[model samples]
Target: MESHVVKIVDIQQVTHDVKSFRLEKPAGYTFVPGQATEVAINKEGWQNERRPFTFTSLNHEPTLQFTIKRYADHDGVTNQIHQLVAGDELILHDVWGAIEYKGPGYFIAGGAGITPFIAILRQLHRDNQLAGNTLFFSNKTAADVIYEKELSNMLGKNAHYILSREQKAGYENGIINADYLRSQATDFSKHFYVCGPDKMIADINAALEKLGASADNVVFEK
Candidate 1:
């Protein structure tokens, strides 16, 4: 696999734990929205510790961006990433993902899972094709929601936020189960994009299937 070393140009905190890192885009490097590449910090002893991260920047953008959530509880790559700043370098491997956009439909994401849809939704917004899509984003609390303002501006009333831990006005409360999905979306025939933790993905997939959605219509990382 080919790898390119890119320098971090800037870093912006998107949430309490999520940070967006903008890196130098390599020459001739290209990727479709929703695809991700394996990334490793260009540091001794950590150069081989590659982790998959989705691209949050558009292809036309001069720099590549990754919105990552740090798990400080564990001594992991993301924790290391949170400590990086401008002038740091990272190695990016080949881009690959299966969460491509098929059509305007419901996008169900949990916490950091929203990273993959960031680029895809941004592209759709830029092209003025974001009208038919609806995003059902669930987080533990309002503070945990990433790009909340941007997503709301992009999708308007289509941006739905559900808080699983906190109950607040203007946000739905509870987990996104089969009943929740059924209440929010009536059409199970439309395409569904889901991403999150392994268990969340599995549960959502089963819920979608139980709601009469065909397995072929659901798009997710396999």
Candidate 2:
């Protein structure tokens, strides 16, 4: 496998705990919207500690972007990654086959899982193919929603926000179960894109199947 050492170009604080890092795109290092590559910081004591991160940037863009959520408790890779600056360097490996866009449908994401869908939705919006897509983003609180403004701008009223722990004025409450899906989803045959923790993915996929979505029509990190 080959590797590329790239320099960070910019960093933006997306949410309270999430960050967007823009990095130099190595020549010929193209990746699909939902693909990811193993990444490691180039600083001492961290060169070989690689973790997979989804590319949130479009394939045709000159720079690469990664939206990452920091885990202060873990004190591991993400914590160290959050401390990186614009002049820092990172090592990236070849891209891996991850989630892919398969036409318009409902996109369901939990917490940091929204990273992959960001690229897909952006690409679709740029191509003028975002009309039929719906986004259902679930989080613990209002502050945990990443790219809230951007998603709402791109999706308009199709963007749904659900809070499992907090009940806000306009956001929906309760978990996304079969009953909730059956009530909200108008078309059962549409493709379902689900991403998040393994348990959440399994539960949502099962619920989608129960609500008449076919297993083959479900797109995930499998």
Candidate 3:
């Protein structure tokens, strides 16, 4: 509801179409993982559009951070965020979101949808609460996988990457389906969190029901 003026302190391209921005919060910034805030940039004093992006960093410090992936040939909010440089002042709205990590179990993420899970995984790993969690990340190509090195290092066998349009050994090359999900589950009682394109989320939700994962066991962004 409320907004504050903040500065973009850092930006790093995570992939060909993805980047991460680190912001210096104005005085007292606060937000939880999975929450999001609106940011607006202006070159002419106050003439910029605002965009909402999920907070990929845990709320533990004053500095705020977010990971964003750009759409091809698009010059909208995502592109604007990519163009930001150090010392750029922007307006940051207060964080708000009801979807969050309620512990972990089975995480199904598609492409850039892995952003929230990245932050959640880090927090869980730090707290030793990720032992029972399994992540199945789907992307168009290997190059599109964000946080690959970190996920591999932290997840060990609990993590898997699925490339839908590329062939690779060990990694499945196709849309993730009920069969594939069932193969990875050692327990049917695990909770499920599905985040991605609308179609992917819909498919995953159906698959969960087919596996007897009740409505209460599956979580999705409304």
**Cα lDDT of model 1 by residue, 44-84, tens digit:** 98999999999999999999999999999998999999999
Q: Using lDDT as the measure, name the better of candidate 2 and candidate 3.
A: 2
Which of candidates 2 and 3 is the stronger one according to TM-score? 2
RMSD of each: 0.7, 0.8, 1.9
Q: Alpha carbon lDDT of residue 59, candidate 3?
A: 76
Better candidate by TM-score, 1 or 2: 1
lDDT of 2: 0.92
Report lDDT per candidate: 0.95, 0.92, 0.81
| RMSD in Å for model 1 | 0.7
**TM-score, one value per model:** 0.99, 0.98, 0.92
Error at 184, model 1, angstroms: 0.8
Top candidate when judged by lDDT against the true structure? 1
Top TM-score prediction, candidate number: 1
Candidate 1 residue 1 C-alpha distance from true site, Å: 1.2
Give the alpha carbon lDDT tens digit for every residue of 48-135 in model 3: 5877677877778567788989775866777666777888877888777735777668889999888777778887878788888888
